[model samples]
Target: MVAGPKVVHQSMPVLDVQYRCVAKGIEETVDISAAAAAVAVVTPPSSPSFRPASELDLRESDAISDVALDVNVLPFVPSIRSGSYSDIGPRRYMEDEHICIDDLSTHMGSLFKCPTPSAFYGVFDGHGGPDAAAYLRRHVMRFFFEDTDFPQSLQVDDVFLEDVENSVRKAYLLADHALADECTVNKSSGTTVLTTLVFGRLLLVANAGDCRAVLCRKGEAVDMSQDHRPIYAAERQRVVESGGFIDDGYLNGVLSVSRALGDWDLKLPRGSPSPLIAEPEFRQALLTEEDEFLIIGCDGIWDVMSSQHAVSIVRKGLRRHDDPQQCARELVMEALRLNTFDNLTVIVICFSNEQQDSSPSQQQPPVLRCCSLSAEALCNLRRWLDDDRSN
Candidate 1:
């Protein structure tokens, strides 16, 4: 799950829920429509729910020009709150992994002069085996704060924020390196990593592979991470340059993702670089009252749901009862109803004070995007890739 921060200054206002799965399984090619219904939203009877936006509308997501900063806009930011749960969809064992840490930034603050109590969220979707995913879940926190060149405390300056971004980049690689160096985990195992770090009003996101992070701003979905598939133009170039070829959209006829953590078996010997990698892309956003929630999930949820559909569902849920956890449950159930046959894990983080006691909607609503396949799907997808080696 990708996630929040606390405000040190005066009052401003603001807002997630969890869902758990019972069965488990590995990779599969999915049709989201078959796994979930169309994107729908529920609003107060007086206020009509908006239709789902077919595409992400991020024109104003990162700009302060869109926000009206006034006396009504309190310096007091919404407290970061998070909830999460995992499920085994159609398999025997669950390989998806996640974390939600509200005190991560705060604990790291001990190293700096000022304490910036931030939150951390991540979702790891594993392939080959669960070992790599499990390892990331256990050690991600260390890889992020200890291994990377993070500052003692966060400064609101551009340079320091850049440092934070670099640290985040290094952290992802470190985790991959640790997995490669470790003997207990499988050498062929791999996983997609999607994480979010919230410091005050700043939200930073990093991604490797297909797990995704989506933010809800004013009931609209804004993508924080893009999928790295071998078929993508730049990603295909990297794979080809690094001596990997794509066949039928699969990397070297084996891996589906162009970038990822672990999968040591896919690389060359003597530290020679392999086409597959653990490097991550990043995005930054400024939080405002209009920003409502964040969703960090593996492919299972995205397999069946659209970003706007997910946002609409959560928004409608909050509009009614304001419970992030229950909203998560509804989304998972929706996927199951539609038939997403993969291990599912979702983390929901809220930015508003909307989850207090509330009423129910006379009508119901809709659900994030990530591309993770099941183990069986991975095997089948592998059969579609063509691996040719020239040394």
Candidate 2:
């Protein structure tokens, strides 16, 4: 196993939590103790318990085999650097919100111990209003890390990955219920969420609705999330089976997307099997040297460009400037240029430390020019040349 911090759970009687929120191009830190407390009190759905390696019975030889296999065969852990940017686009008000934590260990502080090189990112696209997205942005830390009973382990193995995926699923469902319980948020407002987590070499992406995550490996785009639209075959089948109809491509002739959190107006009576769902689809990958970066964006970005097109833009931008922040801005600007109809949000996460030069130098060919000269100037030049020759 990779030598790193040992994972352990610790409770904090008093907590000081800080998160970065970006709104209208301005970032602010807000305290959400009340919201976090609300999340903490609500228990997550029952699932398999996440047991540490020490608790499991294993032979001494098995431990040695695991260590040898991991150290010798596993790929190197990525050095992550991420940045995000958002734009209102042509919309009157922005309904997209996002969060990026490059170092989860530092952000979470003493509440829990996380695997090395841990990071978390999420994008919430709100409809009906901005309340749902804003609410999720504020309470994301608690819902995903604290309330979900997330797994903790020093090794990134199959067991650990499975537990983490289960924890993330529970977190999504819990956040959906929490939205319904919050009195301040509108019952009709809902948001499509897409979240990505990075632990050492493992990268996990969970998505709902139209938001997408694309991984760039060796200059190629690898889609990590599928768009859950009412018109899609799988989603359409689900909606029909759930007694919901699709009219003009809208779910139940109401919402455009098939899955989302909140919208209690549709999912009313508390878990009665509605077409609209909060459950997310997951995708994961093992990071290697070929993996260059990851791009997560709202529907606005994807609606105007293909996954490969977006990856090419970001790859070119990174090579030109090696700045993830600038790459995110470029994506938003490009989407605007394409005349996207909704709010735009994008996050660019780079995996390596190597910095490329901004531009390459090239030698210019000699210029051939012809110009008219005065007779007197020409005569003087000739005389000077003659004098130099004579000397």
Candidate 3:
């Protein structure tokens, strides 16, 4: 990989201090001290009443053939976060949400016919315009699977994690550029992205903006992504240095999110800081049979529900014999019912198996598509998935 721009390191008092907060029912919030790191509060649910995936009685139908674990995506979206606001900026009164569940996913399953009994899914919440989310729907998966070091054969090794990280970084940069290109109607628009990739027993998640990815293993809900807010230490420092100040909880007194893609209006060069970056904070987990599925969505859903509450709603729906897609749809629908005014997108990918011819020559290498093929060409075969509808 070629060395790119040097990152300006942030050194501040906030980097070393850990703050704690106590709320009545919720556990105390914890602060992270690193500028390049995350401050997260992970509170275990109070009740053992939380169902574990292993403990839940599995319906006979839940069992599938070994091949069924290959990978299949199911997802849903809501027109608006909440109905109260007839208009959210110039976008629309209804929430402008976008989501995708592509069976022909990229990144994790590029070498094989499908992901290894694992699934990949994501949700994009467009803020300035639909361009950002639309870009992720077409690009994030390719980022994860692009590294030359990515193992062609599924073997757990340190290299696996490295590849994952590198891919995420590449994806973020590529997505940012893709959205900024003049191909879109609103090239300066931006969106938040939350995605999950499940490979065999490992789950790698990444996010930007306030979009979130939550996991329910056994029955407890676990946060797998960080919310980037202006109040965040690193974000605050960047804002201040860039000559911007937070006012009323937003970056530079404007956007509510700290990091996102395609905010050209925010990425100005002569700024207190470049509009907050869209670099994603990532988490990796080793999946087990206990991991049923995952949920990825925008802030609209998170605003009205906690991770536990969201998981419970989806879990109940799954128990009622809803498929992954149906579960996702229900979550978004319920979010709208609860009065969320932002766009809502949700994706649920249940691990399934599919047949594949493993002969080395028979394997099809993955292909990536881009407007200016420079980024995509460096990695692998570039294939344009988007049309040149210059509208």
Candidate 2 lDDT, tens digit per residue, 1-391? 1222222222232335433333343323322232233343444434455333223222222211112122345457888899899999999999999999999988888766767899999999999999999999999999998899899887889999999999999999999999999999999999999999999889999998899999998889999999999999999999999989999999988899999999999999896989999999999999888899999999999999999999999988877777899999999999999999999999999987435221234222221111222233233333443465699
Instruction: Write down the lDDT of every candidate, Cα atoms only.
Output: 0.71, 0.81, 0.57
lDDT of 3 by residue, 193-291 (tens): 776655556678888888888877766887888888888888788777866789898887779988887787778652334747878888998765455
Q: Rank the candidates by lDDT, best first.
A: 2, 1, 3
Best candidate per TM-score, number? 2
Candidate 2 ranges beyond 4 A from true positions: 1-74, 354-391
Ranking 1 against 2 by lDDT, winner: 2
How do all models score by TM-score? 0.71, 0.72, 0.60
Backbone clash pairs in model 1 (N, Cα, C under 3 Å; residues 3+ apart or in different chains), count: 35
Q: Give the true-structure RMSD of model 1.
A: 23.8
lDDT of 1 by residue, 156-218 (tens): 668768888888889988888888889999999989999998878888899999888889987
